[model samples]
Target: MSAIFNFQSLLIVILLLTCSCAYIQSLAPSLLDRNKIGLLGIFWKCAGIGE
Candidate 1:
């Protein structure tokens, strides 16, 4: 009985981790692009592109 309980808890933890990872993975690209754009903006200003 204790073994079965442990297995169930382990399964639940794995499922939660997998879901969270997937959620982060989905958001990662947008987060990365935002960072990239921020860097690009700094470079653009340094280069005086709009001036």
Candidate 2:
């Protein structure tokens, strides 16, 4: 049960990170923008949207 909860929490974090990526992209492009692009794609394929 704990393991399953942990996995769910991790997915939530990923979704939040994806949201941040979108926010950052809209706010301003930066060095981290490159990595966020890849992370966004990965999260979309591996998880669901949170925002």
Candidate 3:
């Protein structure tokens, strides 16, 4: 049980890091307004509206 819990915790941490990295990557100013668009895209995806 403890091992399973530890694995879940690690997975959660990894997921959080991945999402944060995606968000940060989408914040690039030189992307020519792509960041804001990507932000909306992320929201839609999270909401299951897209993809």
Q: What's the TM-score of each model vs. the native?
A: 0.45, 0.48, 0.45
Candidate 3 CA-lDDT value:
0.49
Best by TM-score: 2
lDDT of each: 0.47, 0.54, 0.49
Q: Per-residue lDDT of 1-51 in model 3, one digit per residue for the tens?
A: 453469887777656655664565566424323434655555434322211
Which residue ranges in model 2 land beyond 4 Å of their true spot? 1-5, 31-51
Model 1: colliding residue pairs: none
lDDT of 2 by residue, 13-40 (tens): 7667778655655565553445445645
As a TM-score, model 3 comes out at 0.45
Model 1 over residues 1-51: C-alpha lDDT tens digits? 553479887777656655654454455535333433564444333223212
Best by lDDT: 2
